[model samples]
Target: MIDALHIPDFPMQRTCPFDPPQEYAKLRVEHPVSQVRAPTGQIAWLVTRYEDIRMLLNDPRVSADRRHPNMPLTEEVTPQTRRNIAEVGRSLIGLDRPEHGPRRKMLMAEFTVRRMAAMRPHIQHTADELIDAMLAGPREVDLLTALALPTPTRTLCELLGLSYDARDIIQRSANAQLRRSVSAEERQQTSAELRAYVDQVVREKTAAPTDEDLLGRLVLSNRETGLYDHELMVGLTMLLLVAGHETTASMIALGVTGLLQQPEKIPGIVADPAAAAAAVEELLRYFTVVDALPRVAVGDIEVGGVTIRADEGILLSFASANWDDEAFPDAATLDLARPARKHLAFGYGIHQCIGQNLAREELHIVFRTLFSRIPTLRLGADLDDLPFKKDSNIYGIDALPVTW
Candidate 1:
């Protein structure tokens, strides 16, 4: 019997430094749903198996709402941390249907396959501009600073009708807000700053409207439906700015890093633009950026034969689920040619990422252009030397040093 309490020490379940504890693999095979201590020191069930995670994610009894009062926090989280979490929880990702239904519907048309396809040329142009700047400079460059980060940040700025030049300040505030070690006061201040910045942008867009950008459309839709209030709109905008830019940037950097690490793959990525799409899918599966989406049990639920009590929290391990042996054979390896790449890198169920298509388009354009232009691109430093952000919900390299 694998004791849940015996799981190795982990910094924070969501942080990059915190790999799935050693005992997780054994628990997946032995006891897929087992009790574990959360970062806040609260005991919660961890669901590790793929099938079980899928079931739990879609289960109505498993609520994404954190305002349920009885929701559990990780052992390491403070009251202030809980408040921050709750603020973010107000977004669609944390709501169940009929609430999630309408908000997602309002934005669904914007992110459909057709809309994303239309955005490809612009995404490609953005990638090219960034790449041109990178090549214009010295041979040595930080790919994250020059290309990976700015491309998506600019893309989202265009989509949301915000200024691209605000990327640096926005990214800095986002980083500070996401850090677990930051003092409660610091985090609160950062959140307020970010909200104020976004609120100003929203006000500007409302005053001088152009074609329907994300915020404009959202503001219009909310007025019609009377669904989301001002705070919700602000939260949603903040969510887009943070969730949209950071994760996509990480994927671009990490995907390129993955290719450079396997020199053999570079030729294929360069030779065929079509190959980049498949490669992006494989990278998402392999990198598994957003590890898990936490849910609280609204009512009693059973997952993988374990009964979860109402109000208990669960971390649905999307990363582990993607690598589940049954669903993805040879899960440890990255196979760009692998067909049927239906991974939950975007997540699953009602809360499945709303911006997935946008993310895919951005990655496709980025990698396609990068590999084709800089065929000789190589890592300038060892993987270990790369800075990984210390404490964050999203895991990614801090900087990607590259040379061509």
Candidate 2:
């Protein structure tokens, strides 16, 4: 029975037991850490417990670099496709200290609370613009298309100094890369195009400097410290564009959907914007957007009484940890009033998400404005009929159709 349960024919292992194939709870209690096969046919250690996952995230021995030979393959791809994937792995998300340290520090100042707070008014204005457009549209609207997706897209474009007209291409490239479905040739072409665009932007900024946006700041760093080259700058800009837009947009849509599902919470969110801040934390904890953060063990370690060998790849299931009964009592239920809602939705340790403040501000504006503007907003279709992007790394509803 254990073997059968462990070897279920699934794309990814049963990371979240709550969503489907309801046997995950049993597995978590029985085997907090266990070997599971990924879709790529490689085996990896699945860490489910909240405490153990947290410890592993902070462990120096756990490396985020997927280029390491020990890292398990999560998807199947050709040799050329693998090269593109490796290039992405070179980013901070895939690096440990020393290398990750300098890059993170370089960008940290731009994402501080003060910067985010200062940007709040602009974000709110962007949200209002999008919402206004949505209201002007047909009564039955796809909220994800009308407001959720575009809000972050516009924000990121403004923040990174990218032309808003380039949003469609950027979105397509990012979606293709994350989905890992594009042909190797197609992936390479898309990447080159994005890099070229970024390079041109960098050159323009260098020629005649304008206001200091994030990109301009990085360009200045390159000139001053000689630390960032064209490649690094392109990588940084791409990272900001893709990561910044997708995650926050999905969160806003998902968080609002959660609130709509629970009608009783709508009044509270509308009554006080500050209270909605706590609600954002709960929503993040409840619906962890990033399913897992993968790491390769650099040395032998024991977590939750289960031994992990050096060089073994591990998937830290944040969704599972958030729902772990030990960490969150009545973990399955969503409680906005839950104290200390410090969840790993943005990850933990050095790799904790830098744009968390931005994400929070966007979500807060989304929920607060959404409930306030369209008090009667509700799902236009049945719950089960909603289309969700199940295969994507960031889980979200594909189209959130709604009516006022």
lDDT of 1 by residue, 15-47 (tens): 333244345566678888777665556567778
* lDDT per residue (tens digit) for residues 1-404 in model 2: 24745554223533432252244466578887877776566678877788888899878999988677667655555566565555555756677877888878878978999988988888889888888988888889999988888888888888877789988878777665555345546756776677677778877877765555878877776677676776666666777777787788778777877787689878887788767888899889887878766789999998867789898889888888888878889888888767635788899899899999999988888788887888999999887777766666676777899998
What C-alpha lDDT do the candidate models reach, one value each? 0.76, 0.76
**For residue 71, what is the lDDT in candidate 1?**
64
TM-score of 2: 0.92
